[model samples]
Target: MELEQDLMVSERKKKPFRWHVLVFLAPAVIVYTMIMILPLAETLRFSFFQRDTITQAISFVGLENYIKLFFDPYWVEPFLNSLWNNCYFFLIHMLVQNPIGILIAALLSMVHLPGKKLYRIAIFMPTLLSFVVVGFVWKLMLSPLWGVSKGLMKSVGVGSWYLPFLGKEETALTTLSLISVWQFIGIPMMLIYAALLSIPDEVIEAAECDGVTGISQFFKIKLVLILPTIGIISILTFVGNFNAFDLIYTTQGPLAGPNFSTDLLGTILYRTFYGQQLQPGDPNMGAAIATVMFFIILTGVAIYLFFIQRKLTRYEM
Candidate 1:
């Protein structure tokens, strides 16, 4: 009976001290729930209701807002255009940014690179600046009046190629996407670099012993180990790109000017929620757009988690 009592006491003593964990986590949880989740849920709820113009009375609209958004030609065209443009923007980042980031990170990881710290700092410096700052700076640099890009192109004997990229409908979206990539490339580089650093030196040395050196070593060893990190970076990129707003807003203005050439989902949401010069504000429609965006982002994340991530094996090394 004494042994049993002692064992019970020991088990009680061994129980985790959850109070400290709760104390540490409570503030962040409360803040996140209040600020993000609650507001998001409220927005979703608001999408199903309509407000009266005269009495400002609200009434349940079922899927009326969604139906109008899809079936109505006026709203449907711009919404689809913005959706497609957003997808293109995301595709550009995935193709250009990730590869460039990986290359930069791989170069930085080289043991004997001269002034490596300086290079890293210089590369990462752009990412620290606000989206507004990046957008304005790039806008000025690309401005035909400023002639900075033209001068550089002239120096490279490609002066004829210099054009008002931002003003042209043909090139505006791609230009904006590339500008975004330039500013944010540091993120993936830092992530991949950290993943590379986490790798055991002994494992790399063993690969070297087995005649795996240079690019061969990176592909066969480092690449395999960093697959999990790459997967994480990809998902994060998807979320960030889908949610992107500030840079486009600052650079192209709320109208996404030059015949709405650069209109993205973020800009579309802005125009919908807040009245533009030509278009009137529709809060219910805005909510519906927001809901659609939320679902699109959720779908992308789900695909990544279930399909892409499952195939990526994170090795113990």
Candidate 2:
């Protein structure tokens, strides 16, 4: 009798099932499944099969396309070049943009900075512009005949240093990377600034009580606490960099310009699937490249999730 009464009491204590909650969530869940999940699944499925060009017959090719991608000279060279360029692109963001963002964020997070709001708006303004607009504007600004960059350089007595940056094979990719960095640095800065803002006032007060001040306080207290935000931004940067195409396509064209110096995996994938000029498009081969890129990005995400994210200490407020 006692056991029965206890069981009844525990059952009563449990909250009643809320079927209406599911009703509220149903639209979003259904839409996400249709929009995101279905497309990705179909893309993955397409990668495994070979498609006939004439009859439009599709057949299972197993790993034949992937094997070709690895060993074929034409595929291998361009694939490797794009891969290297992507690594360099990511490296520039990680090394140059991230540090500068942190610096700017740290400066902005100061309690009483004059025109801080205006500064933030100005810094982040580029990020709000369309990639096409930014690309075209920069292209014109950098053009020698247009003289924006050349005039600026002359003002600094370095007009002779002006070169056709986008036209040069060696400098083209680096210039694009820098342009991308300039546009996106605001993301990391804003994220880091928000992280800094979330720190408890008590923590900073305690640090000040302990004679911690200025840069030392920022380094020891604020920066340490914002590691999780930094990690999140890093992973976001990785994904954005790997999927980068719009700006490159807008600025440099599908050919990736100057003997393919700025070619990236996304641009390659685009060219492969759609064809360019005399070279015919190969959908099956393009799917293989897409599959490779998917795996590469998936691998990076897995490593970050399982390894790096695990190491980050999530502090309780």
TM-score of each: 0.92, 0.92
Query: Model 1: runs farther than 4 Å from truth?
Result: 6-26, 53-55, 111-114
What lDDT does model 1 reach? 0.91
Tens digit of per-residue lDDT, candidate 2, span 152-224: 9999999899998988998999999999988998999999999998999999999999999999999898988
Predictions in order: lDDT: 0.91, 0.91
Give the lowest summed-lDDT range of ten residues in model 1: 110-119
- Separately for all candidates shown, the number of backbone clashes (residues 3 or more apart, or on different chains) is 0, 0
Residues 220-289 of candidate 1: C-alpha lDDT, one tens digit per residue: 8998899898889889988998888898899989989788878888888988999899777988879999
